[model samples]
Target: MLTFDIENFPGYPQGIGGPEMMVQLREQAERFGLEVHDKNVEKVDVSNRPFSKSGLKEKNISLRP
Candidate 1:
């Protein structure tokens, strides 16, 4: 939900709309086996190997690719 346009993002040549670009990026991530969460992250811990994520929508999310 960005309120403006993006002018410097790669591969766009001219430019891209913020919301449209966000959707495209999300789709691209999903194609690569990413579990996309459209919720706010409440907590995160990256001191260990397998990272930790905590939030109201979900918890114990793995940051490993």
Candidate 2:
């Protein structure tokens, strides 16, 4: 587990803890309609795939979009 001090973050006069800071950041992102998909990306193959109206073809971009 990685950890760090968040003394410079806003709304934490006494300096928020590392985990607490992460939670706060997540909440803020959610509030702003940011999609957060927690998953591990394995591979990506952009060849001979279908393309949308923009003509962008991607075979297998193994990410959470």
Candidate 3:
């Protein structure tokens, strides 16, 4: 699972933000047969074994066996 903590800190020449970068990265990952989530992550809980992650517009998944 790839979690991106993107922030617009004035590096891009065009009008792009963190969200846009995330989309580009997801597309690249998909080319490599990786499953990309459609919704953006809102919160994450990694304190426990089954690391919990919540999405902004959909149910999240627990990375565990």
Candidate 4:
């Protein structure tokens, strides 16, 4: 994804690169307490509340619906 360029992104009138946009988006999301991961999700256990999510680097997680 970082190997390409964006010519007309909304915030950057001139445009932004893929990697730059990724970093910008991450920083913005982290400011609101969101965790970012680059690994593929192997499993998800939503059968119970306050989850026992699997295959992620951060194994301890709580998810609610």
**Per-model lDDT:** 0.81, 0.59, 0.69, 0.73
Residue by residue across 1-65, what tens digits does model 1's lDDT show? 65578889789999989999889989998998888767888887889868878888575677763
Sliding window of 10 residues with minimal summed lDDT for model 4:
56-65
Q: Residue-wise lDDT of candidate 3 within 1-65, one digit each (tens)?
A: 25344344466555455566777768887898786555678888889979878877677787552
Q: Mind giving the per-residue lDDT tens digits that candidate 4 earns over 1-65?
A: 65578997677888778998888888998999887656666677878876655665656555544
Regions more than 4 Å wrong, model 1: 1-3
Q: lDDT-based ranking, best first?
A: 1, 4, 3, 2
Q: Compared with the true structure, what per-residue lDDT tens digits does model 2 show for residues 1-65?
A: 15677677578888877987788889998998876656444444445354211213423333222
Q: With candidate 3 superimposed using the best TM-score fit, by how many Å does residue 50's alpha carbon deviate from the native? A: 2.4
Model 1, residue 38: displacement in angstroms?
A: 2.4
**How much is the lDDT of residue 30 in candidate 2?**
96
TM-score between candidate 4 and the true structure: 0.61
Model 1 score (lDDT)? 0.81
Query: In candidate 3, where is summed lDDT lowest over 10 consecutive residues?
Result: 1-10
TM-score of candidate 1 relative to the true fold: 0.76
**Which number leads on lDDT?**
1
